[model samples]
Target: MFTPVHADFFNAPTLELSRNLLGQILVHELPEGVVAGRIVETEAYMGAEDRAAHSFGNRRTKRTEIMFGKPGLVYTYQMHTHTLVNVVAGPEETPRAILIRAVEPVEGIELMRERRGKHMPMKQWTSGPGKLTKAMAINMDYYGHYFTEKPLYIAQGNPVESVSVGPRIGIGNSLDAVHYPYRFWESENPFVSKFR
Candidate 1:
């Protein structure tokens, strides 16, 4: 049985939280059924000073206001046609967040497959940030939600034995921030995003 992680679970430093989430389960209790996945990859966005982050330079807008709130809050945003989910990290007033890049399907496989539509490779279902959110039915409605509660919450899973660190994907315009080794993933996980 998986136990939901409390708000304190996200109280760690942003980088640590990125790594710690490697093997955790991201559960979304949908009306159709419960869909979940084992987190395999993540990216850390150190707010304000981090040029690659949405809250860079402490810029606060309607979409980024949630990032400046308490840790463990859900920060969902749209990237093109897909909705990406992030876990608010760092202390209060700090806009740091960890983007959930990829996950390995755990529960509600049929539902996930149906939501994703058509029969494709299982790894391809949630191998990318946008793809995972689509498979799990996570959308803009989850923005500013708490990760410590039901419907959507993180749960304990297998411990990560080995981890790999690398630069995050995209955001090539962030200058030197593009080189930051802020991406963390489970070593040799096939479900991890293809970019790395």
Candidate 2:
């Protein structure tokens, strides 16, 4: 049984929340069934000043408006054909967020396998940001949703004994921001997207 993490669980600073998120369970209750995964990887996006962040220089739009909302708000966005998920962090108007990069299947594995196709290896199912969202059935519908609420929410899980940190991936154009050591993951976790 999983207990929903409260709003206070996300009150920590954005960078701290990113590391703290490791080892927590991300649960999504679909009409099809309940699917959950233990988070293994995450990346932090510092608001405004960080060039790699969507709200860099405070560029707010319909899409980024939710980022400026209260902590624990869900921020889902489309990257090409894939939809990725992020957890809103920092105080209101700060626009900071932590991207859920990967997770290890904990429940509803069969459901996730179906979404990812049976032929694919289990590790490949939720081993990346885009891949995890699809496998867990998390889409744009979850945008603006509160992580403290049901249907979709985070839950407590076993603590990660060792965490590895490194620079985030996929945003090389941000220059110096790309080299920032903001990515964190459970050490040696096979479900993590990539090892540092």
Candidate 3:
């Protein structure tokens, strides 16, 4: 049985949580049942220095408020009608996060298939951020919610040792940031984002 870590675990510095979360499991409990998956892909976004980050240049707003909250919380937001999930990182007031881009489904296959609206092969089920959220039943309503407890949480799992680093995906505004290797993933993981 897997259990979630305390919120303080995720409150570490941005770079630390960003790297340590590589192999953790993100569990989503739906009314149908529990669906769990191992996180394989992530991108670190530091507060002021990262141009592609929502908190870039210290631009605070109602939407970015949760980024400043205690870490280990889900900072879900809408992007072109799709809900993208990110884990809040860094100490209080420093607004940093790790975008959960992909995951490999580890439990509740039947529930995931139903939510995806098709019987996708394992690799296709949660290969993208939006797709993973869809499979896990996560949405904007889950924004600002704590991940250590509640409908969504992260659990300790087998750590991924062989990981590859690369640039972030789909950010046209960030000219130089597009080249920064902030994204991390387990090499040979079938569920990694195809965009990279």
Candidate 4:
């Protein structure tokens, strides 16, 4: 049986967690079925100094409050009609997180297809933040939920031998941080998002 990653895995710097998250498996045991994917891309965001971060300058709000909580929890947010998921990082009181940018479908393709409706190329299955959330059935209800428990969790996966690093995608307001190399992805992975 595959074991879920320990909370300690997330109890580190957001950047470290972001890079290491590549190749990990995100498993969601939904009421309908189980869906799993291999993380192929991630972007790190830090508090205050990192202008791209929602908690920048310690600006905490109801929506961003969970970002300041202990590591190993989910920090889900909605962008338009889609919900994106982030892994809360850093020690308590420190607002930081690693966004799961992309993943390669690993299991439950039928369920993912059912959830996503009709059909799409395998490359488009979970190759973006919004796409993966919909494929895995992740939503705002997961906000602030601990990843160590059921319905959803990250499991140990193959170690990445090499990775690519680049600037994060979107967020045009943070001029200086836009050039920061906060994004990490598995090298040569076609499912690592179109931004790569």
Question: Model 4: per-residue lDDT, tens digit, 1-196?
Answer: 5479988888777788888888889999977778999999999998878999999998899999998899989999999888999999888999999999999998898998887776577788888899999999999999989887888899999889999998999978898999999999999999888873
What does candidate 3's lDDT look like per residue over 75-108, in tens digits?
Answer: 9988887899999888778888899999999998
Give lDDT tens digits, candidate 1, residues 1-196: 5679877888899999999998999999878788999999999999999999999999999999999999999999999999999999999999999999999999999998887877698889999999999999999999988987889999988779999999999989999999999999998999999984
Regions of model 2 farther than 4 Å from truth: none
Ranking by lDDT: 2, 1, 4, 3
Q: Ten-residue segment with the worst summed lDDT in candidate 4?
A: 113-122
RMSD (CA, angstroms), candidate 4: 1.1
Instruction: Sort by TM-score, best first.
Output: 2, 1, 4, 3
lDDT for 180 (candidate 2): 97
My TM-score estimates for the predictions, one after another, are 0.97, 0.98, 0.95, 0.96
Query: What local lDDT score does residue 151 receive in model 3, on the 0 to 100 scale?
Result: 72
Worst 10 residues of 3 by lDDT: 7-16
Please give the lDDT score for candidate 3. Answer: 0.87
For 34-125, candidate 2 gives per-residue lDDT tens digits of 99999999999998999999999999999999999999999999999999999999999999999999999999999999999999999999
Q: lDDT for every model? A: 0.93, 0.94, 0.87, 0.90
C-alpha lDDT of candidate 1 relative to the true structure: 0.93
Instruction: Report the lDDT of model 3 for residue 15.
Output: 66
lDDT of 4 at 84: 97
